[model samples]
Target: MKTYQDQIGNVLGLKKTPLRIVSLVPSQTELLVDLGLKDSIVGITKFCIHPSSLRKEKTIVGGTKTINTEKIKTLQPDIILCNKEENTKEIVEACLKIAPTHVSDIFTIDDVIELINQYGEIFDCVSKSSEILDDLTNKLTNFQQFIKGEKTIKVAYFIWKNPWMVAGNTTFINHLLELNNFENVFRDKERYPEVDITKRSSVDAILLSSEPYPFKEKHILELQKKLPNVKVILVDGEMFSWYGSRLLKAFEYFKTLRNSI
Candidate 1:
C-alpha cells in the first residue's frame, strides 16, 4: 500500500499503482487517460466523454453530482478520483467505503498542475505527467503574452437560464475569465448567483455558456431583448471551465476568442 494526499488535505492509502480505478470528475477522468491510465480506469461517469470511446470501454458509475455507489463498488476499484466542487460530501463518504478516494479542490491553474503531479506519483506515470505539465505551462505563458496588451472587457458570463444564473467569485470560470482579460461584472458576488440582467447596468457583453445549461442561439435573442445594447455570444464552456489536458488546447481557443471579440 502507498499513502496519497488529496488536494483537500485528505490522506488515503492506495494499493500500489491502483490497477482498477473509478473516476467521477469529467475533467480529472480525461487527465487520468492523458496520464497513461486509460486501461487501468475501470469506471467513469457518463459525462466523461472526452476520448468519446471511454464510455464504451469503461463502466458508467454515474454523474459527477449523482453517483451510483453500488455500481462503483462492483467495479472493485482500487482507487477513486473526485473533485470537491463536482462531487458531494455524501459521494465522497460512499466512495471511501468502496476504495481509496482522492478528492481534488481546484480554483487556479497551479492547483491543476499539483493534482496532475500527485496523480503521476499515485499511478506511476511520472514522464507522462511531466509532459502534460510542461505543455500546459508553455501554453499558459504564450496566452499570457498574447493577452498582455488586450483591453479588459466587463462581461457577465451566464451558466444557466430560466432563473438566469451567472458565474461569480471563487470559481474556475471566474479565474479563466480574468486570465482571458474578461473582467467579470459579477465578481463581487459569491459562486453562481441568479440575477436579473435588467438590474445589472455595468455589463459590456453577455456570454452564454454551452454547458451546465447549454445556452442556445435562440437564448441569445432572449437575453439581447433584455440587454439590447450588450453583445451576447455563445461560448464553449469547456474551454473556460475544464481543467487538466483540455487546457493544452484551451489557450489556443482563448486567443481565437479574444481576436474575434
Candidate 2:
C-alpha cells in the first residue's frame, strides 16, 4: 500500500488502483471523464454536465455545496475528488470517512499546472497530464506574446445581475482578465461583491459572464443602455472558471475575444 499526497495535503492511500470513484467539483469531474475515468466514476454531482451521457449513468450525490452523504456511502467509492473552494468543509470531512479524498485548491496558472501533474500521477496518466499541461502552457505563452505591449483596457466583469456583482481581485476571472491584458476595475474590492453603477463609469468595458446567472446578448444590450460609453461583451464563463484541461482552448478563445474588442 502506498500513500499519495496531493498539492492540498490530502493523502490518497490505496492498496491497488482505485476502481470506484466519486467527484464533487464539476470542473474536476469533467476532467476525470476527459482523462478516461468514465467507467470508474460511480458518482457525480448534478451540476457536472460536461459529458451529458454521464448524467444518466452516474449516480447524482447532490450539488456542489450540498451533497447527499447517505447516497455517496451506498456507492462506496474508493476515492473521492473535491475542491477547497467549491465544496464545503463538512462535505469533505464526510467523504473522508467513506474513502480516501483528494482536495484541490487552485488559483493561478501555476497552481493549475501543479494540479494537472498531481492528478496525472495519482491516476497513472502522467503522459496525458503532461501533454495537456504543455499545450496549455504554450497557448498561454502565445497569448501573452500576442498581447504584449497592448494597451491595458480597463474592464468590469459582471457575474450576476440584479444586485450587480462584479469579479474582483484574487478571483480566477480577475486573473484571466489580467492575462488578456485587461485591467479589472473592481480589483480594489476584496472579492466578488454587489457593485454600484455610479462607480462603474470609470471602466472602458463591461463583460457579462455566461454563468452564475447565464448573462446573454440581451443582458449586454441592457447594460449598454445604462453605460453608453462602455463596451459590453458576453464572455464564456467556463474558460475563465474551469481550471482544468479546458484551459487549453481558453487562450485561443481569449485571443479571438481580444480581436473582437
Candidate 3:
C-alpha cells in the first residue's frame, strides 16, 4: 500500500490506485468524471448532477449533508471524496468506517488547481489532470484580459432569503466575485452573514443566486423595490461557487455577466 495526502493534508494509505470511489461533493464529482474516472465511481450524492449520465450509472447515497451510511457501506468504496464545507464531520467519521476518506478544503482558484493535482496522484491520472489544469489556466488568463478596464462594481450576493444571508468573507464565492472585479460589500463580515436588507448600505448591484434557495425573478423584483436604483440580476450559482470542472465554463459566464451589467 502507498500513501496519498488529500488537499487537507490527510494521509490516506491505500492500494496503488483506488478502483471504487464515492463522491460527496457535486463539483468534485464532475471533476472526477472529467479526469476520466467516471467508470470507477460507484457512489455519488443526488446533487452530483453534472455530466447528466451519472444519475443512471451510480448508486445514490443521499444528499451532501444527510448521507445514508447503509448505502455507503454496501458500495464498499475504496475511497470516498468529501469537502470541508459540503459534508458534516459526523458524515466524514461515518465514512471512515467503510474506507479511506479524502477531504478537500477549497477556498481559492489555486486551491482548486492543487486539488486537481492531488487527485491526479491519488487516482493515478497525472497526465489527464495536468491537461485539465492547463485548460483552466488558459481560460482564466483570457478572462483576466476580458475584465481589463472594467470599473469595479460594489455588489451584494444573496444565496439565501428567508433570513436574508449573503456570501461573506473567506468564501469561494467572494474569491470569484473579486476575480470578476465585483467587490462584495459584506467582505468585512464572516461566512454567510445574516442581514436586514432594508437597512443595508448602498451597493452598485444586488445579485440573486440560483441555488441553495433558488432566488427567482420575483425575488429580484422584491429587492428592486427596496433599492430601486441598484442593478439586481439573477446570477448562476454554479459559476460562482462550484470550484471544480465547472470552473472551465465559469470564466465565460463571468464575461457575459460583466458585459450584461
Which window of 10 residues has the lowest lDDT sum in candidate 2?
Answer: 196-205
Candidate 1 or 2, higher lDDT? 1
Expressed as tens digits, the lDDT of each residue in 1-261 for candidate 3 is 988787777788987699999999999999999999999999999999998989999999999999999999898899999999999989988988899999999889999999999899889999999999999999999999888889999999999988999999999999999999999999999899998766667699999999888998999889888889889999999999999889999998898999999
Give candidate 2 misplaced runs (Cα > 4 Å).
none
- The digit string of per-residue lDDT tens for model 1 on 2-26 reads 7978999999986577899899999
- Residue 208, model 2: lDDT of 87
For each candidate, the alpha-carbon lDDT, in order, equals 0.91, 0.86, 0.92
- Candidate ranking (lDDT, best to worst): 3, 1, 2
Candidate 3 clashing pairs?
A: none
Residue 177 miss distance in model 1 (angstroms): 0.5
Candidate 2: lDDT of 103? Answer: 91
Model 3: lDDT equals 0.92
TM-score of every model? 0.98, 0.94, 0.98
